[model samples]
Target: MTIRRALISVSDKTGIVEFSRQLAEQGVQIISTGGTFSLLEKEGVPVTGISDVTGFPEILDGRVKTLHPAVHSGLLAVRDDEEHQKAMKELGLDYIDLVVVNLYPFAQTIAKPDVTYEDAIENIDIGGPTMLRSAAKNHAFVTVVVDAADYGAVLDEIKAQGDTTLETRKRLAAKVFRHTGSYDALISDYLSKQVGEPLPERYTVTYEKVQDLRYGENPHQKAAFYRKPLAASGNITTAEQLHGKELSYNNINDANAALAVLKEFDEPAVVAVKHMNPCGVGIGTNIHEAYQKAYAADPTSIFGGIVAANRTIDAATAALLSEIFLEIIIAPDFAPEALEILTRKKNIRLLKLGEFTSAAERKPEWLVTSVDGGMLVQESDVHTISADDLKVVTNRKPTDEELKQLLFGWKVVKHVKSNAILLAKDDMTIGVGAGQMNRVGAARIAIEQAGEKSQGSVLASDAFFPMGDTLELAAKAGITAVIQPGGSVRDEESIAVANANNIAMVFTGVRHFKH
Candidate 1:
């Protein structure tokens, strides 16, 4: 197929000038509308105004320019079809071999700090998508290009074969639909959110690729990282890497787990996570003390884990952190000498996440997961509990110190896997038992891990106890206090056992089941 004519209209003029110059050099007639026409003509390229071919001036501020039949007939008419060719000739319409178009910057426009509704509505492209769809639907004869990266390949194919091959045309057509689909989805998402529709009947979202990871959870799997177009500031994706190589799949998962735990504390904190679970969490008045307490919580499990700090990493804390072979260290900021000491290890990833701001500044977003044949979407688990929310269901009430520890343990247990048990003292986790078959098994694991430390420590369960066996097990471990969401049929049995052992048990009425 010989190239005869082309149409060019773009919002992002990344490579339109050079690509159009190549097409014009190949004796292809170029037709452009509005700003694109002025740009091409100013750049010394041979181009005709879109109105010249359509014999109609642009109306309604260029919104009604390319919607005319003069342009559609040229793009949709089949050269080999007898009736189509006859209709084109009788109407003095010519064939359009190629279409190069990109939509208006509605996403960028809405992303501004203070954009008006009228501005966003006006930026929605009408002619651009219509032109691309017309050309794409007739891909058997017409070629369409939406992405600038494809310009070189399309130009190369044209130069080599005098036209793009059928396969290349099909690929470009598929690319056009994906571009237009995402464009519409973004507009839909923005409008629905503005109108306070949390979950629309037809929901869609868009994300941009950040980078390809080394591998997924295992080396045998493939993975890449994608960021939402409007991700919250200072999130994992927004963190600036100060040293080390790109993050792996496990690294991101573990770091995310560390951040979730770190967000629960406003004081200086350190959280160590491994295998998508927090191995240890500590809170202190300063970063150095927090590091010491967290390491003391579980030194063996902290090895090769992701560590996140809610305070600036000082020289002393960095010195202690550098002694271990940690996979990643993320903090709000780092001192000059601290970076110098940590950077000595070449394989560790160091990230700075600006400041330790509260999650109240966060915008609403869906937590999505992919199942076999469908997807699941829900809001994030940001529910918080305090001493006031606790109901002293047992006859023996907790002391001041035990109540404080129970509140601290409540925050950490919510992030753990289902059938979870967390043992804590002085805001540091001494033992965390997660993902077990039953509540008793999880409690036994936590109690065993705490050992002598379990004597005065408190236990937090993610859900209600199905029976009183867990309380009996805790009683044997010398657990002083307990916190759980109590609604089980055997609640009185558990309360009786707690009273018998003088254990302070409180019902939070909040169930946190993390599967």
Candidate 2:
């Protein structure tokens, strides 16, 4: 499949003129369309207009330009087939050996802050995708280029062998399909959003690769990070890495978990996460105070965990943070003095995120997780707890101070794994037990971690206790009050236990199962 003729049409004209000149220098005739033809003619590239080959001018505002049989027949023709060659010769159709095309900026068009529906629809490139798909399908004879970065490779191949190798053609064709596939998916997603369909009969989504990682969760596995182009702001994908080493697989996972809990508080707060569970969390008037309390809650767990703050990290806090062997530190901003102190440590990752800034409005987001052979998509756990949402179900009602601590514990517990228990006092988490096999087991772990601090701490449960055993454990641990989603069949028994132990209990009527 020696190169003789090539079709060149591109919305992005990057290197198109030079690429056309190089192809013409190789004695290949260049056929172009629309603005591409005008620019090549003006640049003295010796190009043929698409109308000259099709014998028909572009119509319907250029939407119907390249859909004719002349274009498709040229691309789809089998050079080795007798019947196809006979039909092509009889029909006066010529083969298009190479296709250089890029689609209209549909994604960029819709990204405008004030774009109209009509404007978006007009930007969809029908002819571009059609020609690329056709040329890519007949890749044994026709070479296709959808990315500007591939222009050099294609030219090198042509310069060396007068045609692209079959392997290169296959690689380029696979790339074309992926490009067009993501193109179509973006259009489908945009249109579905316009129609307000969360789950249409058909589904399409795409992610742009950010970088390849050293390894996945374990050393033997390969891994890469990808970002959803349209993901909501304030996520780990959108954070700016200001300092330190590249984030590991566990670092990203733990940092994201910490941020999810950090977003639950508007006050100055810090959340320390280990292995996707909150080990410690605190809220206070300032970041230093919050960090101090969070570190005090579980110094052992916070030693190597990821820390995320809802407020700018001040110098005093940064000094304390620098003392720990943390994997990562994330916040809305870092004071210059704080950065000076923390940057001295070489291995810790520092992420600056504007998403947690006060000016950015918190919006509802969809949570997606991959399963064995399918996927799970649901609304994020943005549901929050407040004083009004609490319904006291025990004979003892929580005092004002006790209610505050219970709510704070409730917020932190939601981010922990299922069968979770968190103990809180003075707006800081004293102990967190997560991912236990049983509620009593989780309670026992949390109680042991809290030590003497567990005596006055209020307890927060991610879900209701199936029996009164967990509450009895909490009571013996000296937990004064408890908050949980009370809908279990044995809820009355749990309430009876709370009453017998003179412990205050509240039912939130909502469950937060992180798993």
Candidate 3:
């Protein structure tokens, strides 16, 4: 299969002209359609139009341009078959030796704020994908190129080898299939919104492979980084460390978790995370004090935890942070002096996220977990329950301080696993019982840890009380009030138990199931 003819059609014409010129210089005839052909012709590159090759006009506003049997027959024909050559000769079809095609900007079109359904539909390429799939299917005979960045490499290969090898063609075909699959997934996800129903099949997600990390949680397991398709620029994947060793899998995960939690606060804030959970979080007038208070919350947990700051890290904050043996630190900016002092840690990761904030953006889909042979997917419990949203089920309304503690407990409980309980007072978590089999056991653990502090502290449950056992435990622990989403069928029993204990209880009408 000598590369005598090639088809080039692309939406992103970044280096197409230079590439086409090089192809023409190599005596390879260029075949293109519409915009691509006009651009090549204007750039003084010889090109044959699709109408001349297919012997049919591009009708229906260019929708029915390249979806012809002649075009596909040329691409799909077997080079080794004598019958294929006879048929091609009879039909006056020229063999398409190479195909350089890229789809329309469907993803970018829908990303526009003012995008309309018609506009998105127009961007969905029918002919381009047809050409790509056709060429990709016959990789043994056709060289398929999808990305513009591959033009230089493809040209070099053609120059060096006279034609792309079968192995390279097969690899390029694999890339084409992956590209089309990702494109189709984006289209399906968007169309699902028009029809008010969950997708009948699995919700498809597309992520570009970013980098292969050293290892996963342990040094033995293999790991890699994948960036989501629609993620904004300057995210962790695109961040430059400037100094320090390459990030580990655990370091990247913890850093992202810390960033996610810290970005929620509008004020200057710092959060330290360990094992995918926030161990310490604090907000102050300045980042330095915030970091100090966050580190002081639990120095043991902050030992190798990931620290994230909402504001730039100054020299003062860096000096204080330098003393701690942290794994990673993420922030919008860092002073030059601060970075110099921090980089001395060698193995510590210093990620600069720049001044990018996506706090108000709609949360990405749901959290998914996989067990043995099945998977569970649900919306993330990042939802906040405000005081005004709570219902005073009992006769006694909560005091201002009690309401604040209850809200604080509610927030903390959402971060814990199901069957969770948290006790809070004076804007601090006193005790927490997370991931227990029984609700009563979780309640007891929270109360016991709170000790005499439970006398004035408030308790928050992730789910409704099943019986009076948890209520009785809270009463004995001297809990002042309790907050939970009321959904249990035995609501009367729980309410009666709360009233008898003389503890104020509020029904949030919203559940915060963390698991």
Candidate 4:
């Protein structure tokens, strides 16, 4: 089918003038509405208004312009079918060979911090989507274009073949449905939030692709990175990569885990993560000391791990970091001399994430996880433990210094995978046992790693101890104090074990289980 007539209506006017001029030079009649018509006419392109074809004036603030029968019949007619052709001839309806449309800025309007509900509703495009759907439904005879970025390729096809190919039309039609689906999903999400329903009866989300990663967790699987349209600022997804090789899937995962642990501290802190588990975490008066303490916590595990620092990294810290074989290093900022040294290692990934914000400052609204065939959605775990929430169950109470170390261990254990156990002293983690099958196994692993350092250190568990064995192991390891949620059926047994060993124990009344 050679090009004869085309309809153009768009909110974004980029490339429309030149595109329409090319169509006009090909002897294709241009039919437009509202601003599109005015712009095409000003550009010296011959165009006809919707009223000229539909024989009806635009009313209801331009909402009733393209909903007329003449426009729909022309777009929906099948040119190859004799009956459809006869009806079109009887109604004097011309064939609309192509449709160029883009929806209103509904997503952009609602993204504004102070946009009103009324303004959002008014920005929803009604007739534009209707025309697009009509043309897309009859893609065998009609061509539809929704994205302005595809204008050049589409114009080239039309100029070479006098019309778009059947394959191109089909692909364009599929794109139209995808465009409308995402548009409607954004509107649904906005309205649901307006009514205070963060999770609706039917949840729908759309993401724009950020980049395709080198590979997934392994070398064979393919993966890409995507971000929500209105994502909050200062997140790992928004971090800027200053210098390094492309990030692999595992690199991003470990980096994100490191950042989460780093956010728990307000002072200069460093968190070293391996396999998405915190191997070492430490806080110091300066970033250099913090890095040294964290590295000393577990030198073997820190060999190929990712490190995240809450403060700017200085030249001394950078010099030490370069001595290790690390996959990635993330910090709020890097001093000029520090960058000069770190950039020497071309393969090490360095990210500059400015001004770390705690979860309390910019909390996520929901936590979404994917399963085999379904999705699980729930509120994010942002609960914080305080001194008042602690319940001392054992006869012996923790001293003020022990209480501080217990809280520090508690924060670090939350980021570790369950069954998780962490040992800490002086606000620095000495040992971490993560992803064990049983609480006793995790406790033993952490105790063994701590060695003689376990003496006078406090232990934190992600959940309550299931039985007295974990407490018995901690007692033998010389663990002085422990913090855990106390709701297990065997809580009394564990308390008895703690009392027998004269170990101070506190119940947080909250669990921090990570999977």
Candidate 5:
């Protein structure tokens, strides 16, 4: 197919002028719409307007410009079909050999904090996607380009072969559908949220690739990172890496876990995560003391784990952190001396995140996971419980200090995987046992990890105890109080055991099963 006339329309004008100039130099006639026509003409590239080609002026605020039969027939015509060619000639319709188009910035517009529905609706591109779909449907004859990144390659192919190859056209056509699919998905998602339909009849989500990691949980698995189009700030995806090698799959997961746990505390706090579980968490008067308490929680598990701090890391804390072999350290900011000290360990990944906020304040609308042959989507678990929400289920009520410790343990337990158990005293975590096959197994591990520290400490279970075994185990370990969601059918048995052991227990009426 020889190129004669090409249509160009785009929202992002990156590299378009140069690309149009190259096309003009190749003796290809350029027909563009509105701003693209003006831009090309201003750049000294000869261009024809859509009004000249279709004999129709843009009307209705430019919404009715390219929806004419002249544009669609030209793009949809089959070149080799004699009947289609004859109909095109009879109607004086000229074949458009190529289409360059991109949709309006609808995602970017809606991402603003104060955008209105009227503002968002006007930014939706109608003519662009229509022309793209028409050209893609007839890719055997009409070439379509949707991405700015593909401009140079398309221009090079045109310069080399006078027209793009069939294979290239097919690939570009496929890209057009994928691009528009994501575009429509964003619109659907936004409108669904606007209408108070969180989970729509047909849920759709789209993400742009952020980066390809070195590997997944294991080196044998391939993996990459992607982010939602309008994802909020102050998340692991938006964090800035100040130093060290590229983050691995495990590094990103652990970093996110560390951040989630760090957000639970408003005071100066430190959280260390290993295998996506909070192994150590502490709140203190200063970042240094927090680091000390967190390191004291479980020193062995802190090795090679990711650490996050709610407050600025000071020189003293950095000095202590550098003593350990950590995979990553993330904080809102670092003191000058702290940065200087931590930078000495060249291989450790250092991240400087801005002001941290709890995910509950600005939660993601959906949480999606892949299973077998489909996806499972649900709202994020941003549910929080206060001390007042605790319902005493045993004869012995928790003391004021025990209630505080139970709340602290509950916060830490939420981030741990099911079957999860966390033991805490004061405002620090003493032990975390996560991802066990059974609740009692997890309880045993947490108790064993706490050792002598388990005395008088509080325990938090992510979900209800299936039987009295976990309660018996906690009582044997000297756990004076326990907090858990109480919905199990064997709840009475667990409560009986708690009362028998003279241990105080509270039911949160909510569960935090992370898995």
Candidate 6:
């Protein structure tokens, strides 16, 4: 049988009433539970309560509302099968052709600062997921709509064809599985946290679909944007694009790296990122000056790089930016005139990420990296090390200025892929060596890029140097001090090499391994 009945139960009621009314006009019966039942009745739509259809009153504080056999049998019944039809008819069950449900606000609930254990447990949904899966399992005979945002498409299809096509049912069933899987992942995460295990049996991540990209990194590869759940108030994903064209795969990747680096500084800061690595970073009195200094650090690299500013972009900054061919620009706010001026470059993406300071609103369990046949998963690198955390291992204590440069180098090195080396002067990154095969190779690249700028510059390594050869090379480049997360067995060899040249050395005691 075609979908002639829909069971609508939702925590988010957006477009529900209008959608129900439209469904009613199409002569489809609307069955609902508790709040959905009263709300639909108030909206002047004739609705059958789930309790009435189940032939049992909703008990256990509404937990037992839609769990009865009548609902599941109706949703799962195959109208084309004689046995299924006979059983449903014997049980007096009307086929529930569509299921519209959204789970409880569990993510939002847990995010509250004072959320209690009871509150978190109570928000775990029971009846809604069951109905969604039931309808989805029988997708050949039913359509399951989990997100209210899909209401328009489902309604439009019914209105256009007088019934949804078979293909639409299968597509929606895929979405239903994804929805329930994400929901189950959240529950598992919350329960695991309560048990206080460093790693769980299964690590899961839930991301909402943002958009389907034109293509992935290449034209042949498929790709889509999935916004991480529990995003901060001002995260880039939550930011609005006030002007310009849609963002590409590389644009978003580089822009996110730029924003992440910019979040490390408190002062007015700017970061220029190319190929998911920071090419230049600077801090100054104001955003305008910061952008100028960051750009001046490496103008050639900043040409097509994403620019991230910690503060608002004023007219002065905008005017100066107009001279460059930037891919995207992100800021806390953009002055009215600044936006108008920036909009002149119709292809440049202008993003306003207000109040989002990259302090990590919600941390994820693990990161997934794909290979040809399978993926590698590991815990996210949330290990943070500050200046106070470093231990001065060399005889010579680093001067205040040198310490600042070391910290600056440390910040940039973490963002770079291993094996990584960064050389910094004042408070900005001058040169970086990333994704090399060995520490010595990375050091050579960093020194070559720094050139004369390597003199008196502090060097930071992402991991401990296995040999003192890199330090010897860095010393030849006139490097004064070195900072690394030192746990190497031959750590003394590196320290001896640094001390031999009167270079100050500090061990962060924590390594940032970005593979």
Candidate maximizing lDDT: 4
lDDT tens per residue, model 1, 1-515: 97779999999999899999999988889999999999999999999999999999999888899998999999888779999999998988899999999999998899888999999999999899999999999999999999999999988888887899889889999988888988998899888978999688887877778999888989999999988876665669889999997899888888888988888888888999988777898999899998888888889999999999999999999999999999999999999999999999998999998864574444335898989987888998888877888899988899999998998899889989988999999779999999998999999888888889998999999999999999999999999999999999989999999999999999999999998
The candidate 5 region of ten consecutive residues with least summed lDDT is 356-365
User: Per-candidate TM vs. native?
Assistant: 0.93, 0.95, 0.88, 0.94, 0.95, 0.90
Per TM-score, the best of the predicted structures is 5
Across residues 413-446, which tens digit of lDDT does each residue of candidate 6 receive?
8888899999988767778888899999989988
What pairs collide in candidate 1?
none
Taken over the whole model, the C-alpha lDDT of each candidate is 0.90, 0.91, 0.82, 0.91, 0.91, 0.86
lDDT of 2 by residue, 1-515 (tens): 68999999999999999999999999999999999999999999999988889999999888888888988999999999999999999999999999999999998898888999999999999999999999999999999999989999999999999999999999999999999999998899889989998788876778888888999999999988888766656779999999999988878888889888888888889999989998889889899999999999899988889999988898999999998899899998899999999999988899998755331345666667899998888887778767998899999999999999988888889999988999999889988889998988999999999999999789999999999999999888899999999999999999999999999999999999989
CA displacement after TM-score superposition, residue 313 of candidate 5 (Å) = 2.4
- Comparison by lDDT, 2 against 6, better one: 2
User: What C-alpha lDDT, on a 0 to 100 scale, does residue 146 get in candidate 6?
Assistant: 85
How large is the C-alpha RMSD of every model relative to the true structure? Answer: 2.3, 2.1, 3.2, 2.0, 1.9, 2.8
Error of 1 at 215 (Å): 3.4
Better of 2 and 3 by TM-score: 2
Error of 5 at 8 (Å): 1.2
Candidate 5's C-alpha runs over 4 A off are: 359-364, 489-492
Shift of residue 148 alpha carbon in model 6, Å = 3.7
lDDT of 2: 0.91
Local accuracy of candidate 3 as per-residue lDDT tens digits, 212-247:
998999988999988777766545777778666788
In candidate 2, what residue range of length 10 has the lowest lDDT sum?
A: 355-364
